[model samples]
Every structure is written in structure tokens, then in C-alpha cells.
Target: MESFNEYHIDPKEFTFLKSFQDNWQAIRDEFIHFIKQASNEDLKLVYDILGPKSKTIKTKGDAKYSAFGILFQGMFIEKYIQVHQIKYPDYGAEEASQKALVLREKYFPSLAKLIEKVNFNDDEIIRNVYFGTFHPGLDIKLHVNYNPHTNRGYLGLIVPEGDVAMKICHEQLYWHEGKFLVLDHSYPHCPHNYTNYDRTVLVVDFFKPDKPREEVIQFENEQVTQRMQENPYSLGVFGKSDRAKVEDFIKYGFTHQLEWDKAL
Candidate 1:
């Protein structure tokens, strides 16, 4: 492993960014084409891939001056935004991200394959972009506080070369290609730490297409930005209970046994 000062970012941070940047370009190009052509089918495909608008963050510092952690302050701001969404969804972009995180933690290796199957190849427009933000995918944020019970999922993929996953916990017990997860994310779950060199994955949240989008309020400048600070994971009583339940679900193993006739 490289020294923290050598790259300025810790190994985990460095790996996450490198993986994400590589993977997202491919998805972006495909999405850009869809945006330009505005084909009904392609537009639907884009919506399917990106979902609605994901969260966005304005950079607060210069990308050059900060060494290691210092030079790329804006990048960290975006990361914080992701964690904010994972922790707090009521005011965030989407509910899918946090839900997916919980699902991954609760169930082992269920959703990985479904996420991996996400490919933008069907769209002709995105093929040309070698690099750039051409994809219309929503920018959801994912936050994962360390948990001791289960294995944390790592993000990985073959194309566009960027990390689009939050805390992914790969499961060896139950996994099938394109059907690896038990639930779909409603928000963005950006990838964090891992051991692989080319660690990245295409993040796709599967949910009913009709899920309602939260209304967003935009501000013109920092005047509003200063007043607004991002908070991840709600701290309210209900929210705390929800988090605890997620932990409990992960701790207690799941089974298919159920009695349908009893309820009826």
C-alpha cells in the first residue's frame, strides 16, 4: 500500500475515486446520446438507468491547492453529499439508496448481479463518448457507517470505469448474475473502500418505475449554501429505530419459511 501522504488520500479513498471515474464515463456517454436524440424509447432507457435527478453538490474549494486531501476538496464535498443521502432521505434526492444499503446488509449477496447487469449498450447515442458526463443517471449519495457483523460489499465492473456503488457487501452464499440483490436502491450509493485495483460497479436501483420523486429547491448562490449543511442519516427516534432494525436484520439470519395461510 502507498503512504497516505504519497497520494494524499488514504488507500481506500484513492481506490474508490479511481474506480468511479473510470466506470462513470461509459454510462455518461450513453446517457448524453439519449439526452440529445430525445427518442422516447431511449429516454425511457435513460430514465431506467439513471432514474430521476440524483443529488448534486457545488464545490467549496479549489481542486489544485489541497494536497492529498487538500487539493480535491470539492470531491470530498460530493462524497459527503452521498453519505448525507444515505443517512437522511426525507430531504434528500431519493429513498432507494439507503434502502439498498440496508437490503445489502440485511441479506447477503442478493442484489449484486442485478446491479452488474446494468449496461448502456442498447443506446446508440452513448457509444461515441470516450469521456465526459453524457449519462442522465440520477446522482444519489450513499453512506455506510462501519458494521462488525457482515462483510462489506466491494464495487467492481468492466466498463466506463467508475464507481457508482455505495457500501456493497459481496455475498458468496446466495448470488446469481443480474439477480444478486434483494432490493433496489432509490438513491446513489457511491463506492468506498476496497482491496481490488480496478474496483468499480455499475449502480442500478430497481424499484417500481412510478415511485414519486421528491421536490427540490434550488438556490442561486453560496448565500443559501452557507445556510444549508448536508446531514446523512436521520437522528430522530423513528430514524434511529430504523437503523437499529437494519443492524438487527443483518445480525439475524434470514429464511424462506413463512405461513401465508395464517394471515389470510
Candidate 2:
């Protein structure tokens, strides 16, 4: 195999990312810290928890709202791929769903404890608020498109081998190091992979707030907005998003995630 030694990430960030791969508890702890410190108000917590960062990477398409979710360290994703017998072709969203399902089954009971540390109020929080995670392994790639208008992103990578490489791209974003280089999602980039190793990431979306009185009443009277959809890949097999009741939300839905849930 060609040694992509130039793709390695900095030791500090790599270490931090690694901590989450082996022990999600540590990741939860870090989130708790962000909650206690970064959040100044109740509503802000939702945004802060999901919002994008001001540093690390840059591309186009800045978001109207913030983007926040945890990206599994690459090494961890690799481990999940191995133990589960997950193949390179099975590294997309559906495969990730399977992994998470396994994870849910393996550690159902402990998730609540982890949630508690983050100060997530059981009553106020919706089940789907913390919705299921998204995992896209090497076969699944993310093409990040940034709006030329903003220089608000910094690209990062965390590879098992190679030195860290950083650059400014008006069009393309490549994964080179331990940091899964984050870029503005508004940009038009897509993930494409030809590698054998399965790469995975965690996608978390926070719950929408309770609507105000007038809007709630208006919404109650209105008909549901209908849109046509297609599921050619059978991705919906995971479960309905409506099933995301608050109690069900915290339960681990991805037992497959547990495949690599442990740090190797």
C-alpha cells in the first residue's frame, strides 16, 4: 500500500479524537463541558450543541444556523469495520445505521448515564431531539461545498499515517489527517471513496424547540405539508423518525455502532 504519511494529523487533536473512539464516555464528558460553558441560555444550548465551529476548516456555503454533531475518530471507525466484518462497500449511511443498531443493543442501559452528564432535560427534550447517529465509512464520502462568500472554515484531517496537511480550497475538500477536516456544508462538495477500509462518522441532530402558542395553534389547524420521496436503497429500514419518542431517543439505536464503539 502507498504510505500516505503526509496525511497524519497533529498529536493534540488526534489524541482528542482518539479518546472518543475508544470511550464515548470521554466524548460525553467533553460535551458536558461544552454545555456548561459554551451555552449561556436554554435555547442557545440546542444551537451550541449542534452548531458548526468557527475554526479548523473553511469552504463555501455558510449556514443560516449553526451545525453541530460528533465525528467519530477515524481509527475507531476502522475498528468498528473490522470486528463487525463490515466490508468496504458497506461503509455508507445504511451500513452506519446497522453499526449503530448493534451499539444500541450492547449499551442500552449506560446511554442514560451519559445523557445525564450533558444536562439534557428528560422532560423538555424530544425523543428524536438527539436522533440516531449517521455513519459514512470510506465508501461513503462527504463533498463539502463552501460559498465563496465566506472564509469561515478550516480544513482538518486525521489519517492513521502521514503528516498533517492544511490548505485553502475554493472547491475540493480532502481527508488527509486525524482531524476529519470540517468545512462549510453550504458548499457543494461530496464524499467519494475507493479505499478498502471502512470510514465512519457520527451525525447528531438536536431537537427543535416547542413552538410558541400562536404558531402551535395555527400548525394544529393546518394540513401536513406533503412531499414526494423515494427510497431506492431501502435506507428507511432503520426505523421511522416519528418513532423518535423522548424515551426512545436516548436508547442506543445503533447496535452496529458498538462494533467499533470500543477503543481498540
Give each model's clash number: 50, 64
Error of 1 at 24 (Å): 8.8
Per-residue lDDT tens digits of candidate 1, residues 199-225?
223322111222222211121122124
Residue-level lDDT of model 2, residues 1-264, one tens digit each, is 322222222323222223223444444444445445542553353333222233212223421213333211111222323333433333554464455444333323243334333323332121111212112222222222222111111222112222222222222234432233433233323343333232222232112133353453243222111100122121111112212233332232232245446534
Question: What is the lDDT for 21 in model 2?
Answer: 34
Give lDDT for model 1: 0.24
- RMSD of candidate 1 to the truth, in angstroms, is 19.6
Q: State the C-alpha lDDT per candidate.
A: 0.24, 0.28
Best by TM-score: 2
What TM-score against the true fold does each predicted structure earn? 0.22, 0.28
